[model samples]
Target: MHDEYNVQAGLNPRTVREYDEAITRVSLGYKSVDEYYSNSCSCHVVQHVRIPLLCIQAANDPIAPIEATPYSDIKDNPNCMLIVTPQGGHLGWVAGDDAPFGAPWTDNVVIEFLEHLQKNASKPESS
Candidate 1:
């Protein structure tokens, strides 16, 4: 993603000059590549997702690693659930392996959750 952004920025002459100036001013005497990479996680935003969330993570996803995802913090929420699978490969999990339209695991899980919500919603309310 970062590389793609860099390429796009380079293609724009104005952006290239702006970026070069900014980097020259900010980098100073920095030598290592680690200094330029951002290390912060968006856990603060995760803590604020008050809606009923069903996060499905592909166990082998390289971009969105299961271990780095903010599931643990929100897992205790009554309205939240995290389903981690061994396959899927990022957002590439297709359903029905050889079928025309893959049988995505997300489809079943989301449908079940919605059904559960509908069933519960139809229950009579107590006075």
Candidate 2:
């Protein structure tokens, strides 16, 4: 099934499964599948990251199911913020209420957040 999805995306499907199976076998041999994923997968990796991270997830996104996002892990990480809007397909911020189509709302929000971070960050002590 995963192979079929890769083919649909115009990629050579043969390599995907082969690579995954190889990695899985190695992980199992090491008896560290959980540890490997904990350090690699974004779901687990996010928990240990110390920087301020804002995750804007669209609730209606089909490719990335809302249920899969590790909410408990995110909550545990003091630096992570999970903002789930009601609508917005993969990176699609087509907001209602006279919202413009071209200027994605998400980009604007991200920009504002970055600016706020810049303002809050401690300045360098120059000689």
Candidate 3:
């Protein structure tokens, strides 16, 4: 279903099945797709990210399954922030009071977060 959306949205030039076949032949070197995804997939690379990363995931996103999220790694990492909202399917957090500037809710979130950082940037460290 998510693949259908991607193809319909023109994010991918080929259908999901064709994309999978192309991935298998050109990108994934392992015999099994699971093994290739386990090692080379972007979803599995969060543990290696070294910067402050804010990840926003919808609890009911049809495109990205909740099971694929790096819950444990995000919980264990100080540099990672994971926000799983009950809504916002596939980056659709738009119409809300928080969205004051005709921007997406995620944009508002990042704007507020950056404001917080800027406001607190000059404070001294607490012992």
Candidate 4:
């Protein structure tokens, strides 16, 4: 099912099967493949983010390959930060004390980022 959407179905209109069309219709409530592609692609709107946006992507992720990353779009956005690590598969940032088990390394990174935000929230901006 996952492959049906990410790999085979989402490839192109020519590659989309009847099963994929039905799944998109039922699950996503999208009327057509064109609509699905237009709405589902983040590259279309990532640059429009008004707030600080942190995007951590694994360079070797199989599900969402690094080549598809919106590098140019994100680079132009002052509020967006894109971090592409050499490793970490999909959501598998297994490291720190949690290696081989427990939470991912992103837990600590996210917490630290939030903590920094909280600490700096009260500070006045420099002229």
Instruction: Using lDDT, give the best candidate's number.
Output: 4
Worst 10 residues of 1 by lDDT: 30-39
Residue-wise lDDT of candidate 1 within 13-121, one digit each (tens)?
Answer: 4733345334522444323223332233445466677777778888888655666677767675666677888988868767665653766767877999989888988
- For candidate 4, the per-residue lDDT at 109 reads 83
Q: What does candidate 3 score on TM?
A: 0.61
**TM-score of predicted structure 4:** 0.71
Off by over 4 Å in 4: 1-26, 31-35, 96-98
Which portions of model 1 miss their true places by more than 4 Å?
1-5, 8-42, 97-100, 125-127
TM match of model 1 to true structure: 0.59
Tens-digit lDDT track of model 4 for 1-50: 22234434444545233544645644676766556666777898997999
Candidate 3, 1-127: lDDT as tens digits: 1112223323454444345434542343555445645665446677787867788999988656577787988888787889998987887888678564577768878888778777877888889
Query: Which candidate do you rate higher for TM-score, 2 or 3?
Result: 2
The lDDT values for all models are 0.62, 0.68, 0.67, 0.75
Model 2 scores a C-alpha lDDT of 0.68
Q: Give one digit per residue, the lDDT tens place, for model 2 in 23-123.
A: 54353443343444444447758788899999999898865668768899999999998899888877889545667656678777899989988877867
* Reference-based TM-score of each model: 0.59, 0.62, 0.61, 0.71
Candidate 1 CA-lDDT value: 0.62
- Give the distance in Å from residue 118's predicted Cα in candidate 2 to where it truly belongs: 0.7
Clashes per candidate (backbone, < 3 Å): 4, 0, 0, 0
- State residue 5's C-alpha deviation in candidate 2, in Å: 9.8
Give residue 108's error in model 2 in angstroms.
1.1
* Cα lDDT for residue 77, candidate 4: 95
Candidate 4 RMSD to the correct structure: 5.9
